[model samples]
Target: MGNFVRIPAGPDQSFDAWIEEPPADRFPGPRPALVVLPEIYNVNEWARGVARRYADAGFVALVPDLFWRLEPGQYLPYTPEAQQKGRDLYARLDVAASTRDIGSALAWLRARADSNGKVGVVGFCLGGQLAFLSGVDATPDAVVSYYGTDLHKFLDRVPQLRAPALLHFGETDTRVPASIAGEIERHKLPEQDLVTVVHPAAPHGFSRTGYEPFHAEADARAFEQTLSLFARTL
Candidate 1:
């Protein structure tokens, strides 16, 4: 259902992205495209699964390796040691450059013959934060962030968002608590009404299926809302 493709990031730099396309017989024409941002663990199996899910839903999904600059093809597991390694790599990530890479991905998708010229972005964990940044800096048609850590730091940029945005947070998430989520909701600028959902008792990484701290109910609800958002906006 998917394969790796190279995308030009900047001059003399390129990165691999896992691309999945919906069945042509079922989708039957140019379809909306999606840029699926992976967590700090990079384009691991779970992240690729996300692209597959979006493809099955009739969208062309592409998952870029956000950590390519630091480690070209690193795919860490969900173990404690791997978690620490992911965090370390995440700390060294340059947000501005990664946002540029996302823009390149969007451009690639839009240039594709199968695209309908509509593109959206959905991200998890660290990717979630990048999604929010993309809303502020890039031109994705829509944005969705799941439990994005340090979102409060960028609350000031909410007013600059040109695309409709949906953010999901876990009520009990230590990285992004309910108070922070409330702050984001309250910081709306004029018509920039961002939809935020805080799942009750859900912990960080709630939407990550087959992983610890995954809340099935929250995952289902957030995914439904995400699909609805893309349907209406993209």
Candidate 2:
């Protein structure tokens, strides 16, 4: 039970966010919120499905269009052409600007009448990288990252991470090899509660429902771990 919401990102700029909220009677009071960052494919049907699933599980979830600056409401389908366009948009993305946009979403969630004021974040692929960045910068209460590509590129920022994080990576995925993932596991920030796991025999997009590399077992287990993290932290 959700709908599209307009979120103000910056001066004269706004983005569309797919917002999902559980039935009010499902719980006695306001519920926790989650900001779901989409992959390079933008906030398509699959991304919206993730928000719906979170809402179904008793959370208020929202997925913002990270590419809003480039194109206000872009939703590219899963196709070769769209992949190129998505990559182009990704290459042109200003991490700092987009992170600010995410910060706006977080503020919006906290101010909602039905929110408990606790917010967590989960992201996949490129969004996964943003989840880590957001944890370090936006300061979400909890962060879950599923196979964030090129995550190692941001290890320098880990020391500043202000929240607990749970990360999953596919063991055989070359995009983020074992060596890089291992480095992340070894690096530690004084009080940062970070957990990293490697999904045995899984690939890059293992958690994606209808993607070519989707791994059902791995996806289910990863999702369970995410839920557990949120339950305990948020």
Candidate 3:
């Protein structure tokens, strides 16, 4: 349902993005685009499936290779060894440069002939953090972050966000406790009106299907909210 395409990132640099487009017969006119940021595992099957899901919902979806600089095309499973490897790569990630890459992806999506020029971003795990940063730096039409770790560190940038944003967290996620959500709510800059949802009993990666920590009810609820946001803003 999706295929990889190269998009220019920086000067003389490019990265692969898994792009999925809606059927033209069903979605006749230009359609809104979505950037599906991946977890630390990179553009794996699950991430590609997410792009396909958005495409099925009448939106053009693209999942960029956020870890290209560290290990191009790296895809890992949910095993403990893979988790450690992902953590190692994440620790060495150049967040500023990666945010620039996200900007490039948004530009590419908007430039597409089938695009309506309104782009939104959705991400998970490490990508979730990037999604929040995209709201502040890339300036997409909408942003959704699911259990984004270390989001408390970026509370100061909340005032700089121009796009409508949604954030989700798991009550049982030690990496992002309820206190973090409370802090985020307290720091909400005026007019931003960003939403933060903490699902009861949901652990980290609650939205990730086929994983041990997946919470189906929470995933469905969050996805519905995300679709609603895109409908209203994008």
Candidate 4:
């Protein structure tokens, strides 16, 4: 319960992160680990609950707030005001810096008390892209992406992702068209460690709990399969 911890980033003009750990009481043994990266909204209750769900299933999960770099204490996509603020902040974000911050989270967890050194990563929306990109450098054993946008376009630069990866997509999601997904599949490495699913009748963010776009059946199925994927490869 007291697992919600904040770790400051580099002292020299760097960002800080708000992270949540799974309930220690749920995990009495050394467990495989994962870093739960939040969507553009940062670490909201949905993301925290999802992290706890993973922890409850015998893995240690940590969620890092990626937006803290541009605005401390700022999380988004809840209030219209917060959403606008997050968009404005994004205009000023240094993507390379945000990527570095993701690396920092991985490094922190690798040596932390709760970690078992075996690591995986999972994320939603923008965070999903980070999860995929991090596989190139974040020291994860596997990665799960929930409708990561623009990822197929970056396959050349992101060609080095070595970990097993799973991607979930909504059939109705225009943000990431089926064509792009096809391109991604075509470019996958020889390991062939990629699985992408298009859930029928689901749209973007269908898995976002408590959101209007949430599709109960699709979310349930997606989550069930996603957990299965992570459980196997994490």
- Among these predictions, the greatest lDDT belongs to 1
User: Whole-model Cα lDDT per candidate?
Assistant: 0.90, 0.87, 0.89, 0.74
> In terms of TM-score, how similar is model 2 to the real structure?
0.96
Deviating ranges (above 4 Å) for candidate 2: none
What lDDT does model 3 reach?
A: 0.89
Candidate 1's C-alpha lDDT?
Answer: 0.90
Q: RMSD to native for every prediction? A: 1.0, 1.3, 1.1, 2.3
The collision pairs in model 4 are none
Q: Give the candidates in order of lDDT, highest first.
A: 1, 3, 2, 4
Residue pairs with colliding backbones in model 2 are none
**Residue-wise C-alpha lDDT for candidate 2, range 1-234, written one tens digit per residue:** 578999987688678999988766875457899999999998899999899889888889999998988876778889999999999999999998888888999999998887888999999998999998999879688999888878778888777777899988998887777566678866766567998888888888888897787999889999999999999988
lDDT: the better of candidates 3 and 4: 3
TM-score (C-alpha, index-matched) for candidate 3: 0.97
lDDT by residue for model 1 (1-234), tens: 699999987789889999999988899768999999988898998999999899999999999998889988988888889889899999999999999999999999999998899999999999999999999899999999998878888988877877899999988899878687788877887688488888888889998888787899889989999999999988
Residue 198 shift from truth in candidate 1, angstroms:
0.9
lDDT of 4 by residue, 112-222 (tens): 775667778888877888888887766688888888867775878545777788888888888776565677777776676787777888888888888868889888998
Clashes of 4: 0
TM-score of candidate 1 versus the correct structure, residues matched by position = 0.97
Candidate numbers, best TM-score first, in rank order:
1, 3, 2, 4
Candidate 4 wrongly placed segments (more than 4 Å)? 11-18, 23-26
In terms of TM-score, the best-performing candidate is 1
